[model samples]
Target: MAVALTPLSIPGRAGQLVSQLGDRAELHDVYDETGSRVYHDVSVRDTHEVRELVALVRRIPGAVLELAAGSGRLTMPLLALGREVTAVELSAAMLELLSERLAEAPERLRERCVPVQADMSSFALGRRFEVIVLGTTSISLLDEEGRAGLYAAVREHLAPGGRFLLSTVDIVTPDDPEAAEAVPEAVIAAVGAGGRAYRMHDYWPAGADTRTVTIFPAEIGDEGPVTVCTTTVGVLPVDQLGAELGRAGLTVLSGHPLPGAWRYRDVLLEVGVTA
Candidate 1:
């Protein structure tokens, strides 16, 4: 499927606006437009907690599968560590960037990683995995039925004694406030070699316990302004999440804060095959 590409933009402060987009494809484009330094800085500022989740998984063994692999940030790192990896993603735009990165990767690393374009809810590869991961709070993307189906699908693909690791925001916490009044932000920034810079910002209301992102692009060159694109996402609570997993026939091993008392968003879970 051909993905519609959109330029990164923000109305006022482009930097903050791009920060709000926060999706894999937009972030990848920002990295391509700026540089690794900017990308790393932004990642650290926005997703610092993900590092802890990475550390936790580093101790595990065998092939790992990442559902909704996005632009392959975590998946690539896993391959660099010599772990066999398979990625399943729904967005063609994100997967395209993932494929590009994989092409530039070392042959050995490339050998360890494979990308499959498919939804996490019902994709079947006819194989099981030692470890399966769904990152970036992917579970919340699904409705209740989709979430349940995804749990069953993950369980079906997990090898005996294997585990599934997932990370999500704990929306039930008091800090989240009632979802009706939340404002979502999306920010983008870029600088040209001529010392000129451009930025874009977008904001909108996301549903209850949800985040909405829009991208706008500003041209430092002779081009005009344009609104890039938008994507919406949802967040779920831990207790309700566990019930969903239970319905999928998986057992929870752990769900807690992600090591650093980061934001109210907790790691929320680890599930293993039921005996």
Candidate 2:
């Protein structure tokens, strides 16, 4: 029998809870280590995808800004391509890793890349860019209101003829038993590393659409139980996302299909400004 999908609720303490967990040094350390590993591995699996993104950006003329530029994966590579890249990220730990990577980056690449730590929803850098990219579904971290605010901010910070490129997973599909079961399993496998694993055992409250992912870390032998970190991600449908972007005063340029995925390759939006 197919497991009926149920809506989940965001805890009243959701934001505070994430804030508290993110503040813990030990937890942060583990996340940092795991994230670094993931990105390093992603470069291999997604090289073609990354190349496609870079090719698209290369077609746009001028400076580029990377929103939620975790660990500088795209930032560094774009910089190496001689593009002027400014990275904006929220996590201090991730930013620290980006900074460290920048220090060891080639001089030419370092000259092209700059890192800025800030909240993407309302960040203002006293400057604008011709191209803005929110990579790897990072925008989904925000709620509807927050997503709207972020789109507005992106519009506000775009230069004349500037374009925005956003990517995300499309989770809305005809209910299929095997596919649904595989979706969560694939996500868990991708995120599991360093002897740590995560599983989504609950999607509850039937109205909230909130998901609870439980993390479990264990040693190879006799290390007993390790810590578990639970995080929730907000779900937004493609139509809702498009409507939100439109509300922010942008025109859709393209919504391309991503290869081997149930999502769009990229949703490209253009905002007109007079420089």
Candidate 3:
């Protein structure tokens, strides 16, 4: 399950949408069964971290453990590396989609992936991995305590001289300062891998601790049932995250900045166990 979920809400345009749909609106947690398909469809359309992540993984040689391996976005590419990958996920629904995708992959790649249904914050694989990944900024899904537990688990699961690669949102200070107020929220039209169009709404205020995201069908009528996926994501500043990692006995090795738009940038941090 998606951890420490803040209350889900449909505000602004999406709220107006719900008001229009009335009883016809079907609300779903983004990680739920029906929503997992939507997540998978959308994930298949994204290429955000695949290249940078795979490049880093290629330098490391050994088994891999992917946390919150939803719908096999990074899982598939990680398997393409020809190393044994253990994909740990909390959502059975998401894992189901991943399993189906793996079933259709080439026999060689199909045989290398091991999918396990388990929480990313707390899991015992009874083994270690050279590369332990928690991509998609998924570490933000957990609360403080949960993140601490995750760090401990990662430490326990890292092989000798291993590295833990994770990505988190990086806050960029604008030169104008007024740029944040100028863009409080944005709605973008995107076509998913399933060839369905969606209107994504992201409401993130400057310096806010959390952001609310809502997705709706690009073409929704008033009468029929409409599926709306929503979730709340917490923002973990790079400095704060570094401190947390230090407290957990993990030392930051290097940070690589990723390109992004709309007032948000992602940074992939390479960390190792503190000596």
lDDT of 3 by residue, 1-275 (tens): 33332223655666676677776778788899888888888777588989999999999999999999999999999999898999999989999999999999999998999999998788998999999999999999999999999999999999989999999989888777697777767898888898999998887877789887788899987478888888878899789999999999999999989888677799999999999
Off by over 4 Å in 1: 1-49, 172-209, 218-223, 259-263
Ranking, TM-score, top scorer first: 3, 2, 1
Candidate 3 wrong stretches, greater than 4 Å = 1-8
Prediction 1 TM-score vs. true = 0.70
RMSD of each: 6.9, 7.8, 2.4
Q: Model-by-model lDDT, in order?
A: 0.63, 0.60, 0.88
The lDDT, on a scale of 0 to 1, for candidate 3 is: 0.88
lDDT tens string, model 2, 1-275?
Answer: 11121122223232233334442312212224443443433332344346657877888888999998877777876786688999998877678778888899888888888889888988888888989988766776888777877877887888878888877645434356465544432223343423333332233222234554433332223333223334466655456677666666776666654454431233333334323
How well does candidate 1 score on lDDT at residue 163?
80
Candidates in order, TM-scores: namely 0.70, 0.71, 0.95
How do these models rank on lDDT, best leading?
Answer: 3, 1, 2
Give Cα distance to truth, residue 69, candidate 2, Å.
0.3
Mark the regions of model 2 whose C-alpha exceeds 4 Å error after superposition: 1-48, 172-208, 211-220, 224-230, 261-275
